[model samples]
Target: MIEKRAAQRHRVFKGGTITFENGGIACIVRNVSEGGAAIDLDAPVTLPQSFTLAIARDNLVRNCRPVWRSDRRVGLAFVQ
Candidate 1:
């Protein structure tokens, strides 16, 4: 089996919104960093190729893409 390199990670938790082309949704952030973030979403939600994250704290809004996903979680990579 091929091994995937683990990315540099930082643990963070916050509330954010995920807006798809079809509609908008909400999720809880499991972890985050300048480059990417992991979010725990309820059910299997279809994610946009790209989406915006509205971080509740500083109101830092950033755009990211879905890099990986599971039944209840997704990994997003911040777009440069």
Candidate 2:
């Protein structure tokens, strides 16, 4: 199979926050790459098309847009 991702993702286990207007949720970052990251949510919940993802331990924050989702996992594409 062909890999369509722009960058290779590395496995990760880090805490992250999915933040948007007056709201936020705790998430576990499962994988990361230059292009984007995959996060594990506590449960399935609606999220805005665009939001901020903060990884406190790394002191990194970036805007993200959802690319795909599962019951508890969300794939995000970093936006400039």
Candidate 3:
């Protein structure tokens, strides 16, 4: 089982993208919290234990790490 640290979750439906410097892909934010988010990717990528999320237009970028993942979904937790 996975442990959750969020007190509340906020749903996100905006289009987004993910990149690993060498390549980039499109994805969608399933939901978000102050500290983390879940994403739906069109194709799966081998995620690092920790990475960064660039939120377009908001000028907000975050460093996050994978907490759990499946074939299409991944849960990310912010790195404090």
Candidate 4:
């Protein structure tokens, strides 16, 4: 695959929350960087076009849009 990220991501194993206006789901943060992150769900899920990713352990929350998705993982890009 061609590298397209503005910053490089590093491997991680943190817990995360994918939250929308109505609800949320638990996820595993597989990798992360300043610009974005890759999170794995228990299974493939249909999420909103935009949502917030909350990593309580890191005391971080970012608004993001899905850049790509696979069977269980989603690639996210941070939004303002």
Runs in model 1 deviating more than 4 A are: 1-7
* lDDT of each residue in 8-44, candidate 2, tens digit only: 9999999999899989999999999998999999999
Show the colliding residue pairs in model 3: none
Per-residue lDDT tens digits of candidate 1, residues 1-80? 76453566767777888876678788899887778889998778777689887777858787899989888999888886
Q: Which regions of candidate 2 fall more than 4 Å away from where they truly are?
A: none
Candidate ranking under lDDT, highest first, comes to: 2, 4, 1, 3
- TM-score each candidate: 0.81, 0.95, 0.79, 0.93
For every candidate, C-alpha RMSD to the true structure in Å: 3.0, 0.8, 2.8, 1.4
Per-model tally of clashing residue pairs: 0, 0, 0, 0
Global lDDT of model 4: 0.95
RMSD of 4: 1.4
Q: Give the Å error, residue 41, model 4.
A: 0.4
Candidate 4: worst-modelled 10 consecutive residues by lDDT: 3-12
Model 3 residue 68 CA deviation in Å? 0.5
Model 3: how far is 63 from its true place, Å? 0.6
Clashes in model 4: which pairs?
none
